[model samples]
Target: MTEAITVMALRQGVYDHFREEGDVFEIRKEDDFSAFWMVKVSDAEALALQKAAQRQPEASRHVVDTTVIDNSELEGLRIQLAEKNAEIERLTRNVPGKQADAPEKSAADVLKMANDPTVEFMTFKAAARKVLGDATPSTKAEIIAALEDKATAP
Candidate 1:
């Protein structure tokens, strides 16, 4: 059951609280109460809401231990970084060109490659794999020279 009360004096301040906390939800549609707005609320709910309306909202913020949280979060990040590095190593273990055992031609030999026009240098391909993957490592010597130039660059 529901009832209408002028409570006009109290209505102004409590309307917002009632709407948020309880079911004083919508204003009535009937053509009446010209001076003040009519909010429809259950008598039981209105009583509780009215009491809540009188009290001020609690002023407080949640307390957190930032040092503890930050340390834990950083530990988690470190673990993830280690896992990612391990995964990268695992994935790249068989990726053709990264073998440490592959033979490396000397700087002098690679440098003399400038004289060999048949030496083909692939832009992105590694010297070792280019020999096996393609017909031959025609330009690796030139690429090695370029690499050495960049390495000794000022």
Candidate 2:
């Protein structure tokens, strides 16, 4: 049978003693008094085991080591990022040229409009529509250039 030690009252000294000695034992705290007795074990291994048992229990159900990162995994992540960037560019190219005035009222435009209070947000869209008219090849290029200009501007 496994030897047991009941610790009725816990003191810092007792905890330190167990930790320093590497003694292992089962501990039970006394409900009535502040004193706790260390579960007595005779054998050398048993004593060590009991001391280990007295140490804090593992709180986490699952443990993960975050220091390890494999080269293949990093390469896979890089490929995924590149693919996402490419897909974004492709989709941006595919956006219908008919709604060319939509971006004119975005956050950048709002900020620009603040600078020039005379330029209404609605009027910006109206001006873009008048300039572009129907969706032509030149209009598509113009819209793309305008988007690039807005993106690159301060």
Candidate 3:
């Protein structure tokens, strides 16, 4: 007589019994316990059950509605995305230190920038360098003197 076993029991020792030719296992899920299945079957019955299970999913697939967006809706979404991108760009432009071009500073403005603690030394040096030609002044006093000389020049 054949003994019916649970799916979990197959892993314990029941798997060794299926080595003979035409051996198969039928999984009958218990009505009360959805996760529990009783295993026992013929090779032909198991193959037929597997084929039917494959066909069931394919049949149910055709019943679901496929989502599709119309051209007008797609265009509207694209326009909204573009507007959001432009708004992001506008906001980022106003963020401190993101300026594309610094407004040209007067000699007095350069002096003020040199004196300001927050201003970077390299940035001040670049501005002063531009004004002083080949002279790359290192110290604040040197930069101020160079700018003063350039301001008084004809």
Query: TM-scores across all candidates?
Result: 0.26, 0.25, 0.42
Q: 1-154, model 2: which lDDT tens digit per residue?
A: 4333433223223543433233343444333222343334446657566565557454321144434668898899999999999998877875644465465444354334334668654555444444444541234345545644554768
Clashing pairs in 3: none
Instruction: Output the TM-score of candidate 2.
Output: 0.25
Overall local distance difference test of candidate 3:
0.61
In candidate 2, position 79 carries an lDDT of: 100
lDDT of each: 0.50, 0.48, 0.61
lDDT of 3 by residue, 1-154 (tens): 4444333222223344532222234334433222322345455667775576566655343433335557898799899999999999989987644665867667767777888899888888877776677876778788899888777778
C-alpha RMSD values across all candidates: 17.0, 17.4, 15.3
Ranking by TM-score: 3, 1, 2
Best by TM-score: 3
